[model samples]
Target chain A: MSIGSTIICLLGALFMTSSAFGQAMDAPTDLAGTGYFRDQDTLPGSFRFYQQLPGGESGFWGMGPSRPNLRRSSFKIDAHDDVVYYSPEVRCQKCHEPQTKDLHYLRMGITCVQCHRGQPVAGVYQYYSPLNPIRRHAYVCAKCHEGATPSFASYMVHEPNPIASEAQGRFPLLYYAVWFMLILAGGVFVIFLPYTVFWWIRDLVAKLTRRPSHGS
Target chain B: MAVDRTRLKRFPPVQRLWHLGLLVVFMILSVTGIAWMYFETPWGRGLAEQFGGFTGTLEIHRIAGLVMLAGFVLHLLYMLFKIDWKRFSQSLMGPDSLVFQWIDIKGFFAHLGWVFGLRKYPHFDRWSWWEKFDYWAVWWGLIIVGVTGLMLYNPVLTSDFMPGWLLNVALWVHRIEAVLAMGHIFTIHFTVEHWRPSAFPYNASMFDGSVDLEEARHEHPAWVERLEREGRLEGTLVPPPPVPLRILYFVFGYAIILLGLFLLVFAIANAALLTLF
Candidate 1:
């Protein structure tokens, strides 16, 4: 064979070997593929972050009558007790309507899954779960809100007003004033403490030696 | 035979009792209050557990606060009974009173000068400027902490008349004032009273209600001179603290001083860590 044909054959072998290795490793076709759920033997949709059975009225058996309107698009559970259908994608608005309705950041068009993407339990998204296990909402807030001026980040988003115009709010001025006083008092005490210790030591030594100290 | 040296009556017996009561109550309040404020700390958590958890700690703190308030009220009543109407009115007016005087400003500056080796020690009367400051700080702390504490103790009720934020303000004030009061009493007041070279070891005058004649002459020469002029110098003489009581003072006083020092270190460390992290 000619040198050019030999080179082409070698390139073909290399490409085939790489493709085989990739398939063996179960590498995703696209970098952003959602990946498959092994237990259910189905591909998880882009929106479905959790792996558990869908929860809510239609998700749980005997909880309520199965609503055909809320059936899943991709998968269905066919058990002896009941057959249920679930959507390919699990959206947070399906369960948490009240909390997510008038959220300040949601008004900015930020999706819930953007901040809360993980599946805490098998069918429960992190934000939808009652127990917020990884409580780092402050750090999350700081990521975007804390820009040039970090002090602005101290403003509590939940309760923005310092004076309680309603049933509940913190007095920021009072909080800061108290902190200032505490820091000032602590600073003064620290500065004076060494002098006191010195005096005490001097007095002790004078008493032991039975000699008259200058101040005494 | 050596002539028995005369001592001067400084704090009266009633005054001494009040001081002791206030000291003990203040210490208890400080411990419980600080523990509750910093409940996340190991020492605070241990104290809470020792006192039977958070609720128990708060109960003890409230009780101690109330006791301190009562003692303060009794002190006010005692002063009312002791002082004549004329003296009371005079105290309301400036000089020779515990109220800050122009002389105190001068004396404070003079003392600063003396401290810097610019002059001799300023001649102090019955109460030095710092002593008067210490006295009034207690009154200030009591009013602020007491009123705020009352508001916080019944926040639900208080919120009916006032806004809920006011209760928040009260809580902030109460905690800060408590810290300030504890810090002042444990460090500055302790230093002035017990750790001063002149007051070396401890000042027994508050405990025993008597001062050594020489100490009286040295520390409060103006007052001693005034007593002599009034022919009350001899009347002021009293026996020193009894041996057993002195021994008790020696032990308890040192222990208290050491405890205060330890607390001072802990407070500083806690503050530094909190600020840094």
Candidate 2:
């Protein structure tokens, strides 16, 4: 992309997408790098990003129902009972229904030409390998889900503090302090717990069983 | 009904006020801190929504944490100035002082023996070994939480002096210490401090700043005996609190304890459900 195009993209993103924490979202102008996205699987066990955008109905016996529409555009699973996950089906024109047909990156459906640019293809259908395999898929999906052509949500909104999820190599002070705290708490709980529980029960039993002999 | 209607001082106004402050701040910190730490959970998400959102909850946690640390500093200052320099040495090693003595070590075993019915009710002074332990636990907890909290609060500044990884260390330490505090305070403190039958329902002494004379004698026979020997028992006595003041103490104590118990139970149940399923 040219410098002029980059500037145009950034400027366009500023107006198009804003975050809850107030920052201009980066428009994902380069779609191929985002990652491979297959909209729907053909069969039951064949699912990746989503299982299948099941037909609009109450669904089969044990499976969850498909969504009525994408107006809400939410992503969730029943967690406890859902047998299979599904997504709303996406036909080309269902997404590309805008008047400005050329650059409807915000509300448009994806096509082969969008990311493949000039790459050769042998068949009508072939799974494209993710250009940036290292990036999290959640982030790649967030480009469209959270933003129009861009994703403006701060990293804080997207993920936890980077240092927190991964281990910080070796810190003795941390281990020592954690151990000290654990030992202190553990010692109190382990050593005195029997006596503590015993006394509590004793007090409770004494209260329940014994009558107050003194006059009121 | 004829009530003895005699009272003795247990905590002063400053200490009582500090206790109230700690209660409020600790409650806020625990709720806000856990919401973020356990954000992935349903309860965590539910609480985060109550405080507006995750960021809002985080801000509240930070502010309340700073307030707690400030209260801690003020308390230390109060302790220093509250004491008389003329008797500084005595205060350090004094029987009345919160400082641990050889007797506390012995008292620990004696308490165990008494609990098991192997010994007579162990002798106790103004502060029992467990009481001192409770007091000092909070003291050390603040230091750990405060230091690590500050480091996490400003990772950039902390990372300048120390490695970046210390923040992770700080995170776990802060979390473990805090959870332990919640567990200890909710279970053990509630059990021993106010739930004891003699002090059952609610201990008005903490709020009204005086234990009934019977209370003092029951829990602190050695202290009461010392007062009697020094001819100070009569001077230390006061009339019972008014019925309305007693009612207020009951309300206040129950509110805090009930909230604490609810939180403890909720956390345990939530963890159990998450783990089992």
- Best by the lDDT measure: 2
Interface Cα RMSD in Å, per prediction: 15.6, 15.4
Q: Write the per-residue lDDT of candidate 2 for residues A1-216, one digit (tens) a residue.
A: 999999999987876665434764454453223332433221122222122222112123212222223221112122112323322243334533431222123213355334322233111112332211213223343444432121111111111122231211122343455567778778877866666678787667546755321111
lDDT of each residue in A1-216, candidate 1, tens digit only: 999999999999999999888874554453221223342223334233222222112222322111223224222221111314334265656654544532234334476644444432222222322212112223344345432121122222233222233212123444355556667667767866765565456556645766443343
lDDT of 1 by residue, B15-71 (tens): 888888988888777777766655656766676787887779889988988898988
TM per candidate comes to: 0.61, 0.64
**What is the TM-score of candidate 1?**
0.61
Q: Which stretches of candidate 1 lie over 4 Å from their true place?
A: A1-172, A179-216, B1-5, B87-96, B270-277
Between which residue pairs do clashes occur in model 2? A25-A152, A27-A150, A53-A87
- Which ranges in model 2 have alpha carbons more than 4 Å from their true place? A1-177, A205-216, B1-5, B272-277
DockQ of 2: 0.10
Residue pairs that clash (backbone atoms under 3 angstroms), model 1: A52-A122, A52-A123, A72-A85, A72-A86, A72-A87
